[model samples]
Target: MTSTLTAPVQPETVHAIEVGVMQDRIIPEPVGPPSYRASYVTRDTAPGKARRGVVLALKTWGLEQLADTAELLVSELVTNTFVHTDSRTVGVVVTRTAETTVRIMVLDTDRAEMSVPTCPSGDEESGRGLFLVAALADRWDIERVSTGKRIWCELDTKKVQP
Candidate 1:
């Protein structure tokens, strides 16, 4: 596993930053409060920094644990886009519910059905991205968009601070 460090900000300070970020950033209008979004394009290169930034942003919401899990989720999602879908444009959004649950959604161009991450044989080299996401995320699912598809996984921090 890759490693990245996020400067720890106090919960109150992080909460404030989250509010400011949401206020300054453009957000889609949903039924309830608009969710925060972060988008990136995948490539043959790894998506480590992008994943780290995402984890930091969510840290402001006191979802540090969720953010940690999200790093893996986002990495897998972005990596999958590069591996499975030929498209490089990948978008990720972090949506929170009134119940204080956060969902990470990754959008990629290939609407032609997707596959779940299954455990590879012990000696095998790979095929465990989705498996990690499945284990870390509370729940996950996929949806078809007008252009491509969006794969989402929900993480429940269980702490409703923000």
Candidate 2:
């Protein structure tokens, strides 16, 4: 292993500081959001892959109670990208916004805006992803960006049951 010495980190200049995995950064900091991001190939397994990442990050942050709901919601987002877009890969982010709140984001490379989610009838087999997200998440949204669309949902630990 090669080690190189560098200048000390001046608090104001470093914008993307990452705290150790097990440690929580003090709230109200100027650093980037505390998030875990992973990219998975767009395919049948993408949703599960995204879910596992969410579960792991939540558990690491000692927010185990949010993991299950977070997993289900994020999987829906990931699955949407895989099924609806021409994206080759999808990005998933699990962000801890507070001691009791978390945000999940799914991004893809297709620029088309997602159709407004509708609650399907009981006999419908498809179109339930966003419905599940809307019903389960504390809040959720869709944004069309330059590269593609970003779909995100938030959940608070206190609102979820273990």
Candidate 3:
């Protein structure tokens, strides 16, 4: 009898494949109140897709007035992940923490060893993403994780006028 052997898969390779698989799957709508989540590949259009998803979810939850600001914040966060890191994909989650509060989180496979967020000068062409997030979000924070880092921002949706 003869046997054949297969090559061993490296952990990094497995992780990369898993991320790729995740990018192709559709993000399911939140089952209960207060949350929506999605994943996207790192591409020029990823931010737009993410923004649309968040806006749609907000609308479904009767938060139409908050769509503009929420979309903008989501775009900024998603764009930053695509532009600043070598990560091939990113994940976005929107959560309603309270009747008036909504939180947006973007996850990327980049480590926290990178530079922190900073405000750019007038002459700069870039580096203003986080500054915009700070201005628009009621509160924001970044946390490092085993796989990557998550940047989150909160908005008071109740303040939005119809």
- Per-prediction TM-score to the true structure, in the order listed: 0.70, 0.77, 0.81
| Cα lDDT tens digits for candidate 1, 1-162 | 999998975332221113322321223334664456655545644357447656765776667766667888988887888888876567667777645678778887787776655679999877887887788888998778888998899877664333
Give candidate 1's root-mean-square deviation (CA, Å): 12.3
Tens digits of lDDT, candidate 2, 1-162: 999999986553222223333221112224576678776777787787677767878887888887778888987888888889998778787788886789898988997656777778999899888878888999989998888889899998887666
Using TM-score, give the best candidate's number: 3
Candidate 3 structure quality by residue, lDDT tens digits, 1-110: 99999897543221122443554233555366567777788888789888888998789889988899899999999998888888988988888888899899999998
Judging by lDDT against the true structure, name the best candidate: 3
Off by over 4 Å in 2: 1-31
Give the lDDT of residue 81 in candidate 3: 87
Model 3 C-alpha lDDT versus the unseen true structure:
0.81
Q: After superposition, how far is residue 33 of candidate 1 from its true place, in Å?
A: 2.7
- The alpha-carbon deviation from the true structure for residue 103 of candidate 3, after best TM-score superposition, in angstroms, is 0.7
lDDT of each: 0.68, 0.77, 0.81
Residue 155 in model 2: lDDT: 92
